[model samples]
Target: MGLLMFYEYLDKVEQLLEQKKDIELYNYLENMHAADIAEVLENLEVEDQTQVFGLLSDEKATDVLEQINSEDFSSLIKALTYEKKVTLLDLMSQDDIVDKLIELPESRQKEIIAFLDYEDAEDVKQLLVYEEDTAGGIMTTDFVSIKKDYSIYYAIETLRAIAPDAETIYYVYVTDDLDRLVGVISLRQLIISPPNRAVDTVMNENLITVNVNDDQEEVAKIVTKYGLLAVPVVDDSNVMLGIITVDDILDVIEEEATEDIFRFAGTNEDEIYENDDTLFERVRNSVTSRLPWLIITIFGGLLSATVLTSFQSTISANATLALFMPLLAGMGGNVGTQSSTITVRNIATHAIEGVGIFKTLIHEISVGIFVGIVCSLLVAVAAYFMHAEYHIAIIVGIAMWANMTTASAIGTIVPLVFKKIGVDPAVASAPFITTTIDLTGLTIYFSLATFMMANLPK
Candidate 1:
């Protein structure tokens, strides 16, 4: 529904609640989609949110919690009593329970775990052991796993028996006696096969799965590459751990994409965009995000200044070389940024497939040469127009070509090397590209000037 309509509904519900017409308010919101109800609750004051939460049926309340983000849910987590929190949490899937608990402090996590039933506590604790970025962390253990010896008829019966608690029934995993994942059968396969056929006969042995310790990004790629509704996660021993659903992959994609963008833009994501952050808080965050790069670039500038100092004698002789410093550094910086941007994206999405890294590098070289030739011609023309020195113009032209080629190489290689070393490519790619290009481009310009003018620096 439109925000206007939702607001209108909220107004009517507020009136109902204020009149102590509990049944009327429940009736009004009970049938609404859980997302809409969550939106209404999110917009309400904490006291009103609690009142509405209290009125919701247990199932509806769980649905509402599932729809809300971790940050927004923190308010309710703080407001509810430990006992009330335990009840609501017990009703949630283990994945949701763990996610909510993570938003709290260690003390709160301990207390919440203490409040859980023995089995639930154990399950939640096991999930908490995995880092949040791993497939095991995002996966839910609430999936169907059946023995392969069972008949198709028996499999159908068993599926019906456990369907209520299973997160998704589209694919039923088959495991051996030791609980090792062996195969999977879709609901359609089970239904279409002869009832008396063995489960193993119908199940597809060729399966796609990710290890429990694999990064969530890998899991997201697996889902996207295979077009799966859910992918089974397993241990190194092939024991089924859980399943990551497409819905969770959708969330991962958004989070990772937003994170990369924030990194590339040199800012914190929530601090910059979140309205709830106070002005002071955003300023603090923004300063930290940008100040580090500014500091690094300042040092890079000093290095460039040092290089220019080495060329003092060359600049003193002609005075024309000083004018073209900006030409070399400016073009190199721009081209390097472009190259790094493309490489970082390819790395993030693992998009370099049939083309291969070698082919991609070759293609980048071809592009760099094309760009260099065109830009060098312009720089040569500009140098002649400004200095009217043919020799200086040729030197400037060669230097532009060389520096741009160097920029392309640095831009393409820095991010790839960072990825190899387990550093975030996005974190270093842009600044590194710009800094290195400027510092190196100056050396190129000065060296060319000194050699061309036959006036080497002392």
Candidate 2:
């Protein structure tokens, strides 16, 4: 249904609930998909959310609860009765259960663990050992695996028994007795092969797998680069632990993108807009992350001011020179930011690998020259119209070219330098680039003005 229609249905349900009409409300909620019901619940107040959830059938409630955001999920779990909480945990996928449990306080986690099935509790405990941003943490243990010695017929039979709980059956893994990853076979291959064919013989032995401790970003990169449907997660011993499916990688991509965007804007990536997060809390989170960069930029601005002070005589002699100061600095900042953003994004996506630093620098310089020439010509014409002095126009044009060239060079180099030094390029590049351009642009503008004005005709 359309979003408006869905909201309308929720309106009717809320009206029923307010009137103590439980049966009709329950029927309306029960008939909707869990995702749709979760959407409806998301729009309601917390107390009403709990009331609506309380009226859902146990199975429906569990499904809908799992679809909500982590903060919402946490709130819902808190409002649920002990019996309902246990039921919801049981119904969730192991990965989802572990994620929710990790969000709870240690005391609450212990209490919840006490009520969980022994196997489920053990699985969550094992997952808790991995850091949240690693491959192991996101993988689902519910997958079908077969012994290489098993016949295709036996593997199919095994899958039938496990299919209900397995996250995906499109691709099946084959492992040795020691649970060492050996090969992988698609369900299509299994079905097309003779029933008696050994899974080992039919399986493709060239399997691509990720180490359990590998960063989630690395895992996502591999999955995206190779177009994998699912990749196996292995321990130090190469024993398969679980598989991270394409769906999980999609979430990783979104999360990584969100983080990068926030970091680019100099904000803490974890900041969220929950009702419990007060205005001051939100401002503190944003400000603390951004303040360092602003401070750095201030220092950069001070340097630029010092440069202009040293050239005050030139500015006093030709007052028109000051008119182009902002234009030069602004253009330099833009060019630098553009180059930095492109290089950083390329590095993040692994599009260019093992390229020589000098070669990249040379290419960027060439690009800067072309861009500088075009921008210089445009600004020179504009300056001619703005200033009556031909020498002043020429000075501004030359300064624009030099400043832009310097900005582009610094932009390309700073991120590379940071990457080599094991710093996150996105977080460091912006403030550094802007600061360098401010200093360099001012220096170039004043120096060019002093030289051209001294030699050129009025």
Q: Which candidate ranks first by lDDT, i.e. highest?
A: 2
Candidate 1 residue-wise lDDT, 135-185, digit = tens? 989988889988999999999999989888788999999999999999999
Regions of model 2 farther than 4 Å from truth: 1-13, 19-33, 57-59, 78-84, 356-366
- Evaluated with TM-score, which candidate comes out highest? 2
TM-score of 2: 0.92
Looking at candidate 1, the ten consecutive residues that score lowest on lDDT are 267-276
- Model 2 per-residue lDDT tens digits across residues 114-219: 7678988897789878999999999888778999999999989998898787878888999999999999999999999999989999899998999999999999
For residue 102, give model 2's deviation from the true position in Å.
2.1
lDDT score, residue 14, model 1? 78
Q: How many clashes show up per model?
A: 0, 0
The TM-score values for the models, in the order shown, are 0.85, 0.92
Q: What is the lDDT of candidate 1?
A: 0.84
User: In model 2, where is the ten-residue run with the lowest total lDDT?
Assistant: 351-360
